[model samples]
Structures are given as C-alpha cells and as structure tokens.
Target: MANTPSAKKAARKIARRTLINKTRRSRVRTFLRKVEEAILSGDHEAARAAFKVAEPELARAAAKGVIHKNTASRKISRLSSRVKAVGAA
Candidate 1:
C-alpha cells in the first residue's frame, strides 16, 4: 500500500533495518545463552569468560537500538552477580 515514491523507499529501509535488528537480536541471545550454559554447568571461569563476551554484545545491541540501555545494564548486572555466585558456590 506504499504507493508514493517516498513511502516505498521508507518501506524498503524499514525492511532492511528489520533484518539487521533481527540478526543483532539473535546474536545477543546467542551470547547470553553461552553465559547461561556456562553458569548452569557450574564452571565459574567459563561463566566469567562467557559473561565478558556477552556483556559487550548486550551493550552493543542496546547502543544500536535493538534493546534498551537499562535492560542491557540490568542483564549485565544480574549475569555478573550470578557468575560471581558460581565462584562462591
């Protein structure tokens, strides 16, 4: 239904952006999942390493507008705390 040239162009841009966002989101999830797996496996060092990698990916996704800044911060905080607990346990 985007008949006008400008609207058609906008639609195309949105489609492209949607794909990019989708990929970014998937990458973030994969990183987080790695951290989770490490934590669940009770490997404190591996959890720390995975968290190190995942934290930045979450922040990058937030910076790129795939997720909110607060959400990313919260996730990083919780993951770090859990990673610490894994070491303590």
Candidate 2:
C-alpha cells in the first residue's frame, strides 16, 4: 500500500529495523532467562555471574531503544537485590 517511493523506502527501513529490534529483544530475554534460571537453581555464585553478563546486555538493549531505560533499571535493581539475598541466605 506504499505508493510513493519514499513511503516504500520507509517501509523497507521499518521492516529491517523491526527484525533487528526483535533479535536484540530476544538476546536480552535469553540473558535474563539465564539469570533467572541460575537464581531458581539457588546457586548464588552462578546467579551473580549470570547477572554480570545480563546487566550489560540489558543496558545495551535500553541504550539501543529496544527497551525503556526505566524498565531496564527496574529489572537490574530487582535482580541485583534478589542476587544479594541469595548470597545472604
């Protein structure tokens, strides 16, 4: 339905961006899941290690606009707190 050449180009760009964003989102989710799995397994050290990896991924995703800054910060805060609790246990 994009009749104008500019509109067609914009559509193509959007499609490409969508794919890239989806890939980024999936990678972020995978990292988060790894952290959650480590936490659920009750291995504080493993969870900390996973969190160290995931934290940067989440921050990168937010910086790239794949997710909101506040959302990423909230997730990092909660995960860090939980990881600390695991260590205290």
Candidate 3:
C-alpha cells in the first residue's frame, strides 16, 4: 500500500536491502557453523582456520548493520577462546 511514488521507491529499496542482508547473514552463519563443526571435530588447525575466516565475516556483518557490534565481538571472542582451548588441550 505504498501510495506515494517515494514510498513505492522506498519499498523497492527495502526489498533489495533485505535480500542482500539475508544473504550476508546466511554467509556469516555458514562461516560460524564451519568453525563450530571444526571445533566439534577436535581439529585444531581446521578450527583455527575457520575462526580466521569467520572473524572477519562477523565483523563485516556488524559493519554492514546485519548484526550488532557487541554481538559480533562476543561471538568472535568466544570462538577464538574455544579455538585456543582446543590448541592447548
């Protein structure tokens, strides 16, 4: 029900932004899941590598407003800790 032309344009913009954000979110989740899977498998090298890949993706997601900054930091912190623990063990 976008009556105004501006509103209609905004709706279109929103739809496009939503699709891009969804894809970014999905990519971030996939990276995080890869880290988790590597951790669960007790593969230190793989876990470390996945963490390296996921950390930037999480940060980028935050920067793009797909996720909050603190949440991204917390996730990266926890995953890095877990990876370190695995290395130590």
Score every model by TM-score. Answer: 0.99, 0.98, 0.98
Pull out the clashing pairs in model 3. Answer: none
**lDDT per residue (tens digit) for residues 57-82 in model 1:** 99999999999999999999999999
| Candidate 3 local lDDT, 12-83, one digit each (tens) | 999999999999999999999999999999999999999999999999999999999999999999999999
> What's the true lDDT of residue 7 in model 1?
100
List model 2 lDDT by residue over 1-89, tens digit each: 99999999999999999999999999999999999999998999999999999999999999999999999999999999999988989
In model 3, the runs with Cα more than 4 Å from the true position are none
- How far out, in Å, is residue 6 in model 3? 0.5
- Model 3 quality (TM-score): 0.98
At residue 4, give the lDDT of candidate 1: 98
Ordered from best to worst TM-score, the candidate numbers read: 1, 2, 3
